[model samples]
Target: MDWSSKTVMVTGATAGIGAATALRFAEAGATLIITGRRKQRLETMADVLTSAGANEVYIHRFDIQKKEQIAAVVKNITADTLSVDVLVNNAGLSRNFSPMWEDNTDGWDDMIDTNIKGLLHMTRALLPGMIDKNSGHIINIGSIAGHEVYQNGAVYCATKHAVKAITASLRLDLFKTNIRVTSIDPGLVETEFSEVRFYGDKERAETVYKGFQPLTAADIAESVFWSASMPEHVTIAEMLVLPTDQASATMVYKK
Candidate 1:
């Protein structure tokens, strides 16, 4: 599992788990291609990665929602290298907490566009190289909601569930190619995830983390690194991680 010479592409690399994961891989001496919509943030991350001993740090300013942009990025990636050793799909969105009957069309579309369509485009765009190379890893950062429904989370949960299912299908589809696929399903991760989901309602976000220590971005980053570093013959098909006090989506215990 020597990552020194390998290359990894991570979406949503500007902050949180994606940023931490990029830092970890860079610290291991891997080359990096990090992408996010924020130009400044992406540039800052590239600098940070270069400072942390990465041999090559590349940044792409593009929106995951744009299929054309994804295709263009993939073309550019192919021009640089025939293949990318690892791909981490971390860019995604969640909707506001509203009942299924509520008129939240925009929020639903956002969730589907990023979580579902974005992931598909990224995978389809780069996976061909991996198949040709016969060696690569794909990590999808999913959530506990992927497996269980939560109040006012129908669309978000559905999108994550799509992720979970796709990871399964990709694993099977790439069996002959030896390209590993894994889904890291995290539970109760304390990050901008909650704040964004609540649309900046600090109290609502805070309540999601009450009475227990939630997993941090770094924790999930470590988990992803571990999954990718495993022997070529091994694949951690899926990983469901939760804080000790939390059991499941609806089973979180509060004091």
Candidate 2:
């Protein structure tokens, strides 16, 4: 439970689940390295983390979609004498909700680039240090979409499905070592996720969570903290979290 000696790197720490997760670790006394594309927000989050009890907070501004940027940041962290004890790959997005044939190609590009490629780049950049030390936890923020494909969300679903595959494969690959890999998939969380998916349409986004008690960013954050705080010998391979009214990706019971 004492994370004072640990260092945790969280991608997409500007808002939502990423921000919540960073704060959770901070409350546990971890040294935090938080990254996001928004410079100002990342800085603000760093300050918040410091105020929340983190031993140290480092803010890095870069798009995870860029491999060079990821590598450069990781290198700088290493140079600073910080060995990451946990890596949270939570930088991801869902662009649109259209059938595969009618969907815009740009949406596809954004989803694939951010959801799949971004996760790979961060893992690739940080896994080396963990392997050399033979200790680390990689917590991926996947989705229920990874387990089931919903109507008009084919590409987004595919990207999450790939997350599931990658998480499994990465765990197996690290089985010989003490490195741990886990995917935390959530059904419905009331956050900016819906707003972003709807291209900033507030009303439309509100409809998605209407008449239902959806999970919050803090809920998922708690799960991440729990998974990372487990005994070194225990590895939780995968966890699927959903709201009480939700059963799966497509089955949400609204009041």
TM-score of each: 0.96, 0.98
Worst 10 residues of 2 by lDDT: 95-104
Q: Candidate 2, residue 36: CA error in Å?
A: 0.7
Please report how far candidate 2 places residue 153 from its true position, in Å.
0.4
CA deviation > 4 Å runs, candidate 1: none
Write model 1 residue lDDT over 161-219, tens digit each, in one string. 99999999888788677899999999988878888887788898898888878888989
Q: Total backbone clashes of model 1?
A: 0
What lDDT is reached at residue 61 by model 1? 89
Across 191-251, the per-residue lDDT of candidate 2 in tens digits comes to 8998989889999999999988999999999999999999988988889999999987878
Model 1 residue 32 lDDT score: 95
Per-residue lDDT for 86 in model 2? 95
Query: What is the lDDT for 140 in model 1?
Result: 99
- Model 1 has an lDDT value of 0.90
> In model 1, what is the error at residue 16, expressed in angstroms?
1.3
